[model samples]
Target: MKPIVAIGDVHGLEKWRSIVDEHEDCTIVFLGDYLDPYEYITRRQQLDNLRDIIELKKRRMDDVVLLLGNHDLHYFCDRALPGSRYDFQIERFAEAMFNANIELFQYAYQQGNRIFTHAGIQHSWFVDDFKGDLTQPIAHQLNNPESIQFNAMLRLGHARGGRIGKIGGIFWADISELTDPLHGYTQIVGHNRVDDITERCGYNDNKIIFCDCLRNGKYYYEE
Candidate 1:
């Protein structure tokens, strides 16, 4: 099997360039958040970085998988989500770029029992909210959520500042919201920031691996 290398939230960093170049032979999954950089990174730099990523995907379609994160969604979607650090200054440009190449992005990716998403999936959110099918690959359901399912995917749980009882969707789930990983699957996600690549095991030996450590100069890799 080809090796898999998962990159975490970009936040306008250029480190991804080096990582991708180093893993040219591997299947690279970008965990999104390509925009909304820290104050240090200029908006132009952020925009250019995003363009570079899109171009890379265009050049290496077979080897790259881009999963949209909450940050990326605010720019792509019509409705605005409640969150800080949204780059309104460049929204028009970013939105256009995303729409133009939307086909290159998806909500999730899967391989065997491993599923990759921007954020972790909670049990209740999957069973009650998402209403996903266990028999089908998660990516298929998520990438093609129906109107209602699509709205569900935009939910933000309490941890992320949503209503008291709501559970966040795949794109917005916080690490704290995931009390249990989805049954019979290992979820790889990158929305919540962490000090390092972290792993939590749940029922049936299912697991959720948090990889949003790009800010700390870390990434996850496996064969």
Candidate 2:
């Protein structure tokens, strides 16, 4: 199995640097929320940082998998209306990010006969849902350019169940652990801000790891 280093959420550049330095050689899983509500970076600086990170990931071959959290999709859409409710200083940069045709989400490794997804997959979808290898199913169903465009159309608010309840919400879609126990593979997620890791046990025993991030100046998960 490849050594996997999944960073929880990067709201601060310093914390991101720490994770990168600590897990340099491991396959890096950046568990989204790369935008919004961080005082460490100016809105413009945030865009530059995002671009640099994306570039670094490409340079490092396929070592990095960027899984989109709710916040990322919000930023992606905020590019359209600069003064919208969720719009921030990064709006201009959003255009650049979009025009570059960068991807917002990714899946990690499938190892030891089990696959890994960023958010938990619904009971409706899994590796067995595919007719061919895993990649083919993902590309045909969710990861295609047209599919991404469709998924990106709905705003985070609309995607939330509270506003208009449904199982198809992006949060519910990616954060798959909360909905069902993945019977076939281990599904990992990072969105529910738990004080510590939350684990669930069931017939299939799906494991959900809600990793911690930096709060204030302290690294929450560093030990």
Candidate 3:
């Protein structure tokens, strides 16, 4: 993989499919949220999308990294669910995916020096939890990926029956409140909806880039 393409929330799978062809010389890091079908999408269709992605991961384990978002974590932990979602159904579908690709659905992926996750890391939590560091701590946690800790940092959030604004976990962060408290690498994330991919300077040499425009139909191709 030459250049890495970090994708935003997969409300369904259109965004994911749209960027597949762009993977010729690049690794694809899919930020999760694979369930909760959009208004026009059906549950079966959503599962099919997920199934295809899971299969892709199986085929190209090294080339594809599937990081969990709040929704994915909801099914993984089966608690603190953000209202009544398809937790049970998604769990059933994800069981096969997770079992076959256990190491794939980690909390975050660090490509080069940049960190990619479903939601951006909370500025404060990165300091508190990870001891004011980004890449190393995230990589270490992903090594184990246990349920309790992953849930606290990943799934506990706004629409998922948790508080709206706080320095939560990687998957639970609200990007708007994120600050760059670390140095070195940039953090690329999904979850928060934006019109286009935007980059902002952080406290140190770090950057925070938002990659959630697919929800609004604003793609990299559009630019």
Candidate 4:
């Protein structure tokens, strides 16, 4: 099998450029959160970084997969929603960019029994909110607009400051909200920040790998 390189939340960092360069032959999956950098990185830098990532996708259409994270979804939303470090100044530009290349982004990706999503998927949330067919490929069901509601994917659980008893959906799920990984699939995701790449096992030993440690110089590689 070809190698797979899963990158973590970018947050306007340039380390992804090097990771991609080193793994040019591998399937590159970005776990999203392309914007909203730390205090030091300027808004312009974040915008430029996003443009570069989009360009890379254009160049390597088949090899690269971009999943949308909560940070990114705010820019695409019809109106302002809750997001950390949201910049009103770049909203128009970022929205335009995303709208133009929206086809390149997706809610999930699947290969064999492994799935990739912006935030780890929870079993309860899938059963309650996902409108897609469980028998089908998870990514296919998610990417097809006819199969799911766009707004449903944006749900935020109580852990991330939403209503009590609610579990966040794919794009907005917090690590705390995911008590167990989705049944029958090993999921790789990035959303909640971590100090290093981490893995957790749930029911039936299903695996959920968290790789949102890019700010600390880390990524997940599989062959």
Candidate 5:
């Protein structure tokens, strides 16, 4: 398998440029959240950060994968992301950012048996709810997300919350309720808080790794 360098939440940090530059050959799967600056940051910094990230993906198209985050979903919704407390709002520039790299921003990417996403998956959402074809790669289904049925599945499963009766479903999942290792793949996720980039949930062979560790404007990755 190609050595994977999975990065976590980066809300417009310039250090991403250096991180990508350093890992010129490794496959870098970036967990999304490339927009909606922090409360204290200026909008210019947010634009610069996203622009840098977009440019990096453009330059490293095959090596980098940009998975969509709940914040990025603001474009799909008329309102702000959940629990953002209105501190973050959508803007016109978001359209440009989304348009620039629509092909690169998938919902999931797989490296060997480990999969990456803005959040983890709820197995039920795939097998039971959507009835997605198991013969196909999940990434293929996510990338071809123009179907109305698939869009419903995306909204139900990709946003934060216990929409699945109990808990866990990519963006909204509490991580604690993931319960199982999500059939066939050990999921790597963002959208949750952790002190370190390598912090993981679950146990043994079944684990969910959290990598949204951009607390400091520095780049981080899991080898």
Candidate 6:
């Protein structure tokens, strides 16, 4: 199997560009949070860099994947909602990301149900919950011809939390729901920034891998 390199929470593109340039053989999975909190007015440059990276990846490899995060969802909300509390820079950065057609949730799987998503999968999903292949319609819509269902799925209650039962935003549901007998998969996710290389949750079975070691325009790889 090809080695996997999952990038975490890149609000800017410079850092990712360097990493992408260096790791041509390993498939790079971008774990979302592509907008918000720009330290400088380089939104244009950063976005251009991101576009270049995407184009390069698409040309050079067949497995590059982009996983969407909650912040990415904010950009997709059509209008900025109240109490968002997101950084001011997000507005412009989000616009740029949307223009590039980046959205939430990207996945890659290899060997023994190994998968990479922006966040963890729930532990309680039964066999019935999954239509087929676990990814099913979500992946099909993305891969098929002119499908509107993919975009529609994004509007589901699970995408955004509200005054309702536990909606399981990208981070919580995807990561915590691996407790059921039918659920079995390892997912790489981003959202909560972690200074360390790895963080574990629930029993020894469930885990969330955060790759936020690099800060201030640099890519840090662990192991």
Candidate 6 similarity to native, TM-score: 0.64
Span of 10 residues, lowest total lDDT, candidate 1: 78-87
Candidate 6 residue 184 C-alpha distance from true site, Å: 2.4
Which ranges in model 5 have alpha carbons more than 4 Å from their true place?
Answer: 76-90, 146-153, 156-168, 198-205, 216-223
> What TM-score do all the candidates reach, one by one?
0.97, 0.68, 0.81, 0.95, 0.80, 0.64
Clash pairs, model 3 backbone: 82-160, 82-161
Top candidate on TM-score is: 1
User: Any residue pairs clashing in model 5, and if so which?
Assistant: 159-172, 160-172, 161-172
Q: Write the per-residue lDDT of candidate 2 for residues 1-223, one digit (tens) a residue.
A: 4577666656535466666777677776776666664454676666666776677677776777776655565555543222123445555576568546465344333444333443444443333232223434332344433434444323233234324433332233434324564454454555555455555655665544555344422222311
lDDT of 4 by residue, 36-142 (tens): 88757888899999999999999999999998888898997763255988888888998999999999998788999899999978876776776656687888777
Model 6, residue 206: distance off in Å is 3.7
Task: Estimate, for each residue in 10-76, the C-alpha lDDT of model 5 and write its tens digit.
Answer: 7665556666668887888888877665656677887777777777778878887888887776654
lDDT of 6 by residue, 110-158 (tens): 3344545454444432122222344543334223313332332232233
Q: Clashing residue pairs, candidate 4?
A: none
lDDT of each: 0.89, 0.50, 0.67, 0.86, 0.65, 0.50
Error of 5 at 158 (Å): 12
- Residue 131, model 1: Cα distance from true site in angstroms: 1.1
Off by over 4 Å in 4: 146-148
Off by over 4 Å in 2: 38-40, 77-85, 101-118, 124-141, 145-159, 162-165, 168-179, 212-223
